[model samples]
Target: MNAIDQNAIQTLFTEARTHNVWLDRDVSEQTLRELYHLMHFGPTSMNCQPLRVLFLKSQEAKERLKPALLPGNQEKTMQAPVVAVLGYDTEFYEHLPRMFSHNKEAKSLFEGKPDFINATAFRNSSIQGGYFILAARALGLSAGPMSGFNNAAVDEAFFPDGKVKSNFLCNLGYGDASALFPRQDRFAFDEVCDVL
Candidate 1:
């Protein structure tokens, strides 16, 4: 890439910040569908996609989610255009025979092993969550991803059956740049990376 393109890539990395305030614009459903299409392609261990997203856009749904939030997150979440409940399915590995192995054999790996099931589910679901953030950015939406809520309460309110568990909440919308804090510093490559 040329220097200008390289600079643009850096801007996408450095300028993208977690937004707490948003504009009063609507994000179309088509855009969200497109975002998911892009995000789902991101690789995960065994290609076991475990992220389940509940997009709360209606006032009633937002109200239902309110009681589960941390005091600090309540306002931003409510004000944002969408509050996405990112969750993981407890029974994710049950589908691995179809998703990963392509045969009936992979089911045996997690059939009765609760620990392995939970580990793989949480790990891959978290990867999918990271993909969600990048997808939002690619869609020209700013995102504020937070884990400051009561997961159990969220699950009870949103996932009453208990098959799905809330992992984190992300507020999505067009950000209000004026409300953004000054950009923060980060560690230099030399400080964070080491080559053997």
Candidate 2:
């Protein structure tokens, strides 16, 4: 397979910023669907595909989410066009027959273990969240992903069924570049990586 172009790489990675200021633009339902279609393709352990998103687009919906946010995250999140509550389902194994069809026993591995279920769901959903941001950028939207909220409040407010758990919150919209803080330094490769 051919590698993607440099500009595409920049769009998805190098130049992407965590936006805190948004333009007064709307994120369409079609675009939100496309975002999910893109990010769901990211790999998960045993093809569990545990991530479930709740996108708050209406003022009423955002208001319901307001109490969960930490003070610092409240303003920017409410101002953004969309706020996605990224979560994972503990009963994700129930779908294994469809998602990992080749393995008839796939569901058995996680069905009865609470700790294991939590670990797998959390780990894989976090990976999907990374893909979520990249997918948003690939589609010309700015992303601001943060975890400063009260998870219990969010889960109770949104996923009251008690099966899904919140992982993080991400705001999506056209961003105000002028409001961005100066780019921060990243650790050099040798400072953080090691050869086997």
Candidate 3:
């Protein structure tokens, strides 16, 4: 198979920015659904897809989420067309039988182990959350992913049942280019990687 072109690389990586400000355009529900359809293919441990997303699209939903954001993040989150609450389901193993068909007893492996259960949920969910951001970018949307928020407050407000816990928040929309800072430097390969 052929490799992706430079434009795809630039769009997904080199030119993408973590947008803090958004334009006035709205994000359609159909676009959100498409984003999920693509990102669902991303890999996860045990195929335990624990990541659940709540899109705060209405004023009322954003109001509920506002109290959970850190002061710096509040304004941008309020302005974005959509804010995604990425969550991890503590009881994700219950569906492993359906998700991990190759391993029939996968659910039983995690049922009684609290620590293992939590670890798997958090680990896989974080991976899925990252996948979601890349999926958004791939779909021609800019995203601002932030962790500066009260997870407990978000969980209480959105997922009060105690089954799904908040992981992170990602604001999605057409980004306002004027609000972006100059691209920051990243570590070189040799600085952060090791050849084993």
Best by lDDT: 2
Per-residue error for 39 in candidate 1, Å, reads: 0.5
Q: Given candidate 3, what's the lDDT at residue 110?
A: 88
Stretches of candidate 2 off by over 4 Å are none
Candidate 2: worst 10 consecutive residues by lDDT? 105-114
lDDT of each: 0.89, 0.96, 0.95
User: Arrange candidates by lDDT, highest first: which order?
Assistant: 2, 3, 1
Candidate 1's TM-score reads 0.93
Give the higher-TM-score candidate: 1 or 2: 2
Candidate number that wins on lDDT, 1 or 2:
2
The positional error of residue 193 in candidate 3, measured at the CA in angstroms, is 0.9
- How well does each candidate superpose onto the true structure, as a TM-score? 0.93, 0.99, 0.98
Each prediction's total of clashing residue pairs, residues at least 3 apart in sequence or on different chains, is: 0, 0, 0
Off by over 4 Å in 1: 1-11
lDDT of 1 by residue, 1-196 (tens): 6455755565457678899999999988888898799999999887778899999889899999999898999999999999999999988877787788766677787788988888888888899999899889878899999999999999999999999999999999999999999888889999999999
Report how far off residue 155 is in candidate 1 (Å).
Answer: 0.4
